[model samples]
Target: MKEVFLSTRDFPVDEKFGLVSQILRSAYSVPSNIAEGSGRSTNKEFARFLDIALGSAFELETQLILASDIGYLSENKLQEIQTLLQEIQKMIYSFKMNL
Candidate 1:
């Protein structure tokens, strides 16, 4: 996988302490929690991590919407990030349901 966090580097510097940072933090949390949970041995514990990841995905979606509304991000950019967030949300949801 590419460095997902690195991909957010292009967000406008004006958003350095705003939507840009929030989106980055939220998106990274999803995968970060997944990896950390995977390190645990129990399925239940892993499910908990997946749940947190789902929340992060939702948070990212919200941040993206806000960024678009604030003109901090273009419609294309919002859609792209939203697509990725949706995919991650689906994956996390599936994992949680299965567990």
Candidate 2:
């Protein structure tokens, strides 16, 4: 989340309400959903939240790709973010399956 914010700080002013906003929302959504899910009373409910988090992770990945395509992010930076996002997605999936 911090990384997303930091990276977007360099984006064009026009993107403050565009790609940057979308990217930040999606990036934060992943963790927020996960945290929300963890507090659910039932495993099923938790799994549902994890599902949402996973979806957000995928959404964030797409936004990152779009940013790269637009030259807002470098290949290296995108790769770094992608790697971390993938790990988070995998962890969420695994935890959900166990639930």
Candidate 3:
């Protein structure tokens, strides 16, 4: 997610409050939700948080695709983020299942 944030540094200033913001918020949400969820007293609560994180991941994925399509991101960079997103999704799913 830090990488994603950094990657957006070169984005046009016009997008500073648009696509870039969305990407950053979505990237940050995953961990923020996980952290918030961990403080919950119940697995059910944590699972719900994971669901929110997963949703953010999916949203981020869509934004990334848009970034790539609009030429803001390179195919290689996009693939890297996509692969990481997949890994994150799998890990979150596994954690939810374990709960």
lDDT per model, in order? Answer: 0.77, 0.90, 0.94
Model 2 per-residue lDDT tens digits across residues 1-99: 677778998999999999989999998898899899889999999999999999999999999999999999999999998888888889988988887
lDDT tens per residue, model 3, 1-99: 777988899788999999999999999999999999999999999999999999999999999999999999999999998999989999998999999
Question: Compared to the true structure, candidate 2 yields what TM-score?
Answer: 0.96
Question: Model 1: per-residue lDDT, tens digit, 52-86?
Answer: 98898888778768766877667886677677768
Which wins on lDDT, candidate 2 or candidate 3?
3
For each candidate in turn, the TM-score is 0.83, 0.96, 0.97
CA deviation > 4 Å runs, candidate 2? none
Most TM-score-accurate candidate: 3
Pairs of residues clashing in candidate 3: none
Q: Which of candidates 2 and 3 reaches a greater TM-score?
A: 3
RMSD, one per candidate, in order: 2.4, 0.8, 0.6
User: On lDDT, who's better, 1 or 3?
Assistant: 3
User: Which candidate would rank higher by lDDT, 1 or 2?
Assistant: 2
